[model samples]
Target: MKMCRTAAIAAICMCGSVFAQEQDRKFEVYGFADLNITKYWMEDNAAFRGLRYDDKLRVDLSHVNTYFDFRPNGNTRAMVELSFQGDPVANRSTAGTTVYTVSQGGAVNTVIGTLPLPAAGETKVSETQGTTLEGNSKIRALEGIVYDWGSFSIERAWMEVQFNDKANLLAGKFITPAGVWNVDHGSPVILTVKQPFQTGLVSIFPKSQIGIMERGRGYIGDVDLDYSAYLSTGRIHNTDETRNSLLIETPKDLAVGGNLSVNFPVASGLKIGASGFSGMQKQEYRQRIVKVDITKPATDAANEAAGLVATGKLDPTGIASYIQTKVGEYVATQALNPDNHSYDDVMKAQARENVFGVDAVLDVKKFSLQTEFNQQRIKNQLKNDSLTKTTGFYGLASYKIPMGENARLTPYVMYERVMQEGADNNAGTFMSGSNTGTPGSVLEGFQTYVGGVNLRLFTNFIIKAEYSYADVLTQGIYKDHETVFDAGALNIQFSMAF
Candidate 1:
């Protein structure tokens, strides 16, 4: 860890010196990075075997971002952001009593002991190092780095031609201009945690999409209003790759789209804002052979009450006939088992699809609401299988109390529900590590509820703690099947912005 920090510091100093020398005489350079220290815990006694804290007290330094803007003269400028980042780190338990500190190249402390595991009855985990309970204080997970950090490059490249404060036009690749949290870069002002769930669903957002847009702002009488209209190139995560090319062949591809936003004061301290985007998106995937395995209960009571057989959804006779245990390529002993299981060499069925969606946000003082609803248009011409066209939305509310002068307090709550579509074989559980595509046996849509409190000292340094609960029930095509995988996450973070 010490060596890691030392090398990182040296590299930053070198980069800063070089950049300072290269800055455009009329250009400005600046950006921000989020550095987080968190403890993640999850418990699924049946599936996990026992309670555990994946990466207890771990430190994660997010990707560092630096943006440069060339102001040729007055109201016009070209801007781009270069970024460098490292994966996250977490605590590991060892077979010793003094194992309660987050492992760092630094000294051990009390607040962190083997990355805070779910306190007694908790059942959820956000991020952690996958490790056994055998106990070693050294850090074990380095996956985040292998995948998250690398050579720095222009992550956001765009040019803006502004006519004035009230109007402008922007073109090139850029971040999404919708949702307060969407424009955030590791800052607390945009959220309550290190990341937002919507980011993983970029399948739903047009952020970083290449495009050109027009904007304008002004006041209607005593009220202020802002708006924009844009057109963009198709969303492209598959750029320069075999997977991308394969997607061009799939139905979930984003061929093109248009986006727009409008914000205005509602009344007094309240405000109403709405923004929406629509586009053609499709995903590319490799077609794979699906092996079927259906386990049926001898008694109808178990099948009836178990919630697997929804009304008119499950064909008991057909389901019974299809109950042959055929393992997938990824399901074999060598592939899924840690031991010498030979099932690892099988070929797993791989397929892809494309979809499109629209989303918007509205805020008024202590209450802020955001919603996203999109569907994957079925294109059976490409393949044959049932995929539920999914849709959902989320809302959040927060209140800040200004206590006289120095003390500030805030309380927040948020809720999200993803509706199941008859086509979604996986139900509502968007979580991937587990497979849910097979008929009659699949996980479905996810519903999450979050609430927390925060206190700020001096307004610059903040201590925020939050508790979140998620209930995953009624999954797969119309939420037919059911199980209980309820869990909770508690996180406290310190942040500063300038």
Candidate 2:
């Protein structure tokens, strides 16, 4: 009887110990919180176009992320990370039309030369407003609002399960695997204060995809191959839910893509990868319309032709007929008038929006270098004949100077350039939300230079400051279409992760 009691007690003690160990493995909590401040020194009235730092400086909570981890064992784990950041869309607008210069050099209210004006009650579409005035003006309006600065939102919420050291599966909203900047996009961790424009605006990087991800890694002949494949609800299609092209609503469609990378075992510092995604981001394209009188010109030209025929300056059978034809041709050539001067929402098929990119990351000792080149093809609905291709690239280099054992200062410099081929000149929309109707509002491309430093006060606290210069390239609508404009700013941030 004593032996039985002793054995029972021992078994109960073992079970209790196992339960305690399991409890310890079931829960883990971690996250990061950060503060950021941005100041604009873009000289008075500098045309930043779509970047929102028009003429002010602002400060807000940059990131507050919390992570809850559930691990049942070494081989199985799940995670949930929530981002609490400021609202990215406090500046959005559903009203007010974005107006653009119809004249060359973005000139307003002044006609340059003998630009003809349509007569009274006639609506004309000109480089200038078609009013019977000195300046003929043309205007195009898009239906949407720009993203406002400063608001709070849930940045990421996803669950990940690891099958083993070499394989894993992730479900829910997750970071895109397009580039290094996106994969390691915490403000406290990156070398710089701001992301590259190309990565943020054009590439599949910097956008969250709601989907499932499968990741695997293995060694091949002294080299390592790491890959991630994902299927997600594609990009948001409604402009009303878009803030700077980032969809703010739940996705309802399928977007499939993946990333494959190779890391060398020779050195722990180098990795090269490529990623691509194809999906429909279709939205209703609202074509700009202006009312114009279509009947008067045809009538006046016919009357003139009849008079010419009667005067015999043109023979009714020969020269008169030719004159009438020429008159009709002239009117048709200048016909800016449409049968219906009302606006129409043509459901434009951004039927196929695809992005492909290659990226390389080098972390050799204390020095790190990152670069990526991407090409995005978006089919143009308005100009159905062509597919708009946007190409962009960025290179960033940084060096870390360790201060004692717990702190370090890392200085970095980066350059980025973007070119949009065959984009609408009047689509003065930008991801940065700066110039509403000015320079970049209708910009084509730009070159940017950014330099910054990150100072770690301790293992958990970091201070970062950066200065950036932007050389804006105007679109075809401006006389200085290819000309370069200047914009510059300073950014400072403080952050902690634990």
Candidate 3:
């Protein structure tokens, strides 16, 4: 027993020595954040646009890096970062759900607070149900930290093992490196409000599934190549639930997908690259209601009346050939259930075809030509709806005109077309609410032609001005619309590494 106690004391001494040694290590820090305020003149009832949409301002107050990046001996080091932001503005609409003329008209869902929808657009829809998670229309503060071990996966829980040259295992809630937008770090001044077509909107990562990603730099003979294979359980966040997009977000929901890219160095000062992704993404959604005029066929209306009489008025049970059972009555009675309100009581299967994206950049002297394109096949289980196989694409070309020594001016033109969903259903509005039937105030798909010029002075301050015109896509009578909006800004940033 005496010998055992002595050994235990020795072990404790070793632990104390190790702790003392760790106290000798050191850490490094860097990164910056700023604040920006903006005011826009958007059309009244115009489909709502956001920071990355038309012209919006972005702000950042705090972002720092603190990590013990220097190792004592081994080729190993540890690093961590805590990012922060103190700016937030809601992009929600004034129109949610409204009880239109409740003097005993059509079926009444419930009597909650009423919000008036626009007269020109479809009636407002209510956000009845869906998954719930803390979200940010604009980043407030990022309390997340990043850790790196042995330099495997540079970020997140994924690791870049040394066994393979250009292979990595990516997991955790990490951002997808899909486009040129600087989402790895969020700053509109650095990242264009209108990201390239290949990259998704500001809030969306191309693919941020909580799964594994195997990516690395490799080669196809002398051509030289880089590829990534990813499998994840995730879905794109449904920002506008009232829209006709296929939404199936739920817990236990998984999305498995992958992306591949190949880069070819044609010659000195000349290189080209391409990449794509495919996967199964599903989201379970609640009911989406817009103020839709139900012009039932004479026979259909007669059948509804008969069912109403048979089932009693309080629970009028009607059945259309397409809409089976008494769905309206069932939901009207149970729409507010904590866990029971949904288009389908059970989790429905909705899938979005992995997007096929490609971009090309040509290097010429100090200037470059960059063009990006993407095609999304929004696959839905239920067909015959006009919203099948919708697509969107944008193409822009700019020339960096060098002026004198410390300044450059870039003037560019772009053409973008976003196909509207449910095209056949006139007055078919994309509601932002669930089952409330109110149209979301924002519309994205339109033939928006943009022309802009950006001027940079002393490589620090940049001023970008753009003018856009569009024909809003909707059943509304407004057409051939034209509006002009622009922005001018000044910035200062500096970063040093040790």
Candidate 4:
């Protein structure tokens, strides 16, 4: 009887331990998805047509995201988000080519042949006469389409430690604490189907960073104040004509930035904020051979010298001198070709940038107003390069109307502008070549007007329809000549969170 009573007590203790553990840990899962259909129209300009989205109706399975939140205890929390995004209308194809070289008795012969097209995600390689040729394929849209295949990415993963209501610490990959639009990044939460030109077209600031941040909030005389400071890996210097992933590149220096905001209780949801970042952006331009041509000047020179010697027109001692001169000329010609160089010929471009912005938001009952202004100054560290300046501003207003129970309608309009000066407007300075101006030249700026309406059927579901018109100032051949192009787009989106 005594042993039975001991077993019962132990069983009770085990149950208590299990309950305590459950109370100490917590987990939750949620996600959001969006679908978009868009129609675009632009002036028929050959220079800009290929670079911009085609003028057609396009449907996209825009974003499918899943989020996980966990709390091991009251003071610490973790969050992770996974996103799958791209257009379903996109497709890809691959083609291959092979080049053969044959050298016999100092006479070289070349032949070009076509190989069977490989399937997607496959590479074809052929080797003949001690020469190797490889055919590589990439993912791209079908002919006349400007869409790409779907991609899976980890959007955010971060952990936070709370020390009190006044102070907290967060670290990992997190979104930048910038203007109002960037923070409300989710499609379900954003009021409009289209984002501001600053955030969408030319990103003055990064979307997120891997680093550490310190944030806190406090009350000051019935006014709420929040502030954050962070240090991150920032941007890397990649001049390979292709963008490099931040996860793979090693940063030369760290970036520092901060945000501060104040909310006034008297104004009823009025908030003002300032955010800025300063960092050095660096890039190294490396020359690489994209193709090998066996019939270069050097080969021609060698062949000529051999023929002269066989014909007894050139002496053995004079042949070296003649060949040396020819080789020097060949070197100069190769240098003119940007691709025929080694790592020792790399060029570097480094610049320091300081970006600052101010944002304001006013919410009164069912009416809301938001505006932001951002400016960036880039000072080139290289000699003979001038300072470049870019500025962007946007203002948005919206009014919400009741549409029966569990439904609401919000109509909104926005105007945004982006301008750049003190440098040539090219692909390197702007997000895209076609959107800015002609290469190695300057143009005015771009301005956009947007109008949209949102229908919220439930707290977690929304439908949006939007129209936008944009004008770009492009430069002509003459210094004083400029032209403007009008472009427009219509977008419809459905978003849901669960």
Candidate 5:
């Protein structure tokens, strides 16, 4: 009897241990898949349209995202999100094909051959002599379209150690802490098919980073405040034009930034915030084989300076001019010498970049409105040695439809404008050999209009269709180019989450 009782006790203890283990551990798995198909239309004489008048469709697996969340206890949690995302970098014509190189003064479009991929010892060039591609039907993949599974990438992996109700520490590769889009980038959550240029092209902040962040929330007399700050691996790597990659590697230097915000009890669901960052980024510029004669002056002023130095009494301005002349000659000799040059040479430099922004969101009942404005500056990419300060903003408004039950719809519209100094208009023109008035010949920026409707079927599925119109701002002789005109595009998407 004693032996039987001991055996029973052992079994009960084991069962209790198993029960406790089950109580302490929890795991949840969920995911979403999103796809987008886009079509474009443009005028016959428009300077350059990405897919003008072509019935061909552009299909993208925008995101196939999977998430795993684990909780060992009340104070600890971990999450990981893997995404199979379509490659945006592959949106260019194939190497060795003809493509438009530039648009002149807004009126003239220049076309050129895509330079062949260089061999082991040869140099690769971006432009040559050729005709523009006829249509946008070819899809890039390892094989044909049958094998073009998009990149399986780790989009987010992070762990959180919660100390209390108001504080937590998180670390790992994560979405950026600032910006509304950065926080709500999932397909089921975002309302638009395309990301705004203000948050993407014009913002100096990176989309994601490997870092550590301190986040917390507090209340003051019923008003609430939320804050986050992070130190992350900086932007260092360059896009390997030779081969595309899903993840950038070998981050150098450091990037530090943070966000602070307050929620007001003055109104329901109203919040305002500001964010800022400063860092040094490694910039890569195209390598060109510039032919320079040391005897020839790069600027007429340089020649005058040299002559003044050879003549008479030196003033501070003259001395400075003389130094500039000598430096110019030295740089030309070092950079333009044919024997030391390669078309594949990427000139790398560390440029200081600064960004600041403010945002507000108002959510009331079925109506939601949000807007953000950002200004960013980067060193030494534009003319006259001045910082290229880009200014941009976007305003979005959405209204949820009043459906009875199990069905929901939301209609939304957004307007965005982003202006960058000396950026390409991408209108499908080659601006070649046309530097008449300005030191650089590229166009300035773009403005866009977007409208869409989102439909939710039951709880797990979402359907979206959107239309956009874009206009390019051009300068110089190609400015009036008939082809450099406005463009309209349509995008449709379906998404599911569980």
Candidate 6:
């Protein structure tokens, strides 16, 4: 009986120890979702003829995110975020053929005829007994559905280790520490339905990076200072090149970036910050080259040589020599055309990019103000090296009016401007174009005005409505002409956080 009682007490103690360990480990699951209905329109200008969006009303499941945060011990924490996005559209590529008329000196090569080079890189050379060559051409076509479907992606997955009050180590894929808007980018958290020009439109800094970061905070009298420094894989350009080809490549070098900010705890809140990023972007354009068999064409040419010999125009012994010469010339021509070979890197361009941003925010009583400015410069390292520059700025202000104990109404207004040199500016449109002329030599500008109101019905739910107007102008030579584009949109969104 004493042994049984001791065993029961021992089991109870073990249970208590397990419960205490469980209490020490902390886990949290939280996320936010938002849906938007938008009405959009644009003037029928020739310059904006090929714009992606049309004048119509649309409903979109804009953002859905789920986050997991776990802390197994006092010094370590892990976080993961999953984002649901619109689905990709189905697309099909149609085969095409391009015919080339080869002419050595001033006369066309009648023996080769017109060579039909298909998009797949397969070519056929047919010889005809004619003085003139016929040309045939077919354009490549791509067709896809108009609407996007639903998809899932991982937004952030990272682990953080706390060394002390003044230092912490973070590793994995994390959001880049840049401006205020990018850090608090959730729909439920941001004040406006649309993000600022710099943060969302012409992102001066990359959205995320994979690497390690060291961040900490310190106090100096009444002032507080926080800073972050990181080394990451940097930004990638021409990402679609790999998707279109069979070859895969990753960035060969690392990028370094950092940010610093100062905050004052007076009134509601006040903060000022600056950020910078520098990296080298490498791109290689490649295309697939299908090998073609020249045996049939060479045989036909040799047969023609035999017919000439039968007509007393050549000797039978020269037939072998004729075939060999023809085959050699065909091989030489294929060598000159890189497309005739398989897996060729057609062109390579390398550029170094530097970006800088400054931001400030102030809150006093029910009134708040926020503003930011960002600039990015790209320098081409190849021949005809030139520099291209892009700049963006925005100012926002809002005022809150109390509605009830757990509800409030906030109205806000914003003005933004973005400019690019030596390129066509497509800010806020989610499209980018190559720079032309001398870098930083052409002038392009975009301006936007926005007004909105937010109704916080509950602590974790909000309704927002906004109207925005945009004007764009380009003063550079585009096929030898100037261009302008203007548009407007009305958006209503429902956002919730849990």
The predictions' CA RMSDs to the true structure, in order, are: 16.7, 14.9, 14.9, 12.7, 15.7, 12.0
For each of the candidates, give the backbone clash count.
44, 21, 34, 1, 25, 2
Error of 6 at 459 (Å): 1.4
State each model's CA lDDT, in order: 0.47, 0.61, 0.40, 0.64, 0.60, 0.65
Poorly placed runs, candidate 3 (over 4 Å): 1-29, 32-39, 49-159, 162-164, 182-193, 196-207, 220-222, 236-253, 267-274, 279-349, 382-387, 401-409, 421-444, 451-471, 474-477, 480-498
lDDT of 6 at 351: 59
* Ranking of all candidate structures by their TM-score, best first: 6, 4, 2, 5, 1, 3
Per-residue alpha-carbon lDDT of candidate 1 for residues 1-498, written as tens digits (9 for 90 to 100): 979965865554344422455545566655555565655444543211122224356565655666676789777779888766554212222222112222344333232222223234322121122122123122121111112223455567888888986889888877755544555555545556533455434234544567777777777676666666666644444321122322333334333433344444452243344445544333332222222222455566665554435573555333322221112112232222334222111112222334444454555565555555544432222234444344556666677777656667778777776644544332122333212233432345567788877666654456677777656554444333232345566767665432
The superposed Cα distance between candidate 5 and the true structure at residue 248, in angstroms, equals 14
- Candidate 5 lDDT tens digits, 1-498: 969944743443343221244444577657777878988777666544432234358887677676777888899889999777774322322243233323323322333222233345433333222112222111111101112335667778999999975889999987876767767778888888777866553344666767788888999987788888887764423234322122234443467888888898654588898887755554343444433222324555654556533444434344333333433343335544556444643423334567788888998988989888877676642223345556778899999995667678899999987776632211111221112223443556667899999888767678899999877666544666624566788999998765
Where does model 2 exceed 4 Å of error? 1-23, 72-76, 87-148, 165-167, 201-206, 237-253, 284-349, 425-442, 475-484
Candidate 1 lDDT trough over 10 residues, lowest sum: 139-148
Q: Across residues 307-335, which tens digit of lDDT does each residue of candidate 4 receive?
A: 42444344433433333333334333553
Of the candidates numbered 2 and 4, which has the greater lDDT value?
A: 4
Question: What does candidate 5 score on TM?
Answer: 0.65
Residues 1-498, model 2: lDDT tens digits? 969944743453343221244335576566666777887666555666444455467787766666666777776666666665553534444343333324434444321122233355443222112322122234333333566545554455666778875779888877788767777767666778778876554443437777788998888887888888888766642244232233323453367888889987544478899988876564444443543221212354564555533442433343323322432343345445455244455443333567889999888888888899887776543344345567788999999899888989999999999877755422222332222232223557788999999999887688999999888776555555332257777889888765
What's the TM-score of every candidate structure? 0.57, 0.65, 0.53, 0.70, 0.65, 0.71
- Please list the residue runs of candidate 5 whose C-alpha ends up more than 4 Å from where it truly belongs after superposition: 1-25, 43-55, 89-149, 201-203, 236-238, 241-252, 284-347, 381-385, 422-441, 475-479, 482-485
Q: Top TM-score: which candidate number?
A: 6
lDDT of 6 by residue, 341-395 (tens): 4555533445567889999999999999999898887766653545557788999
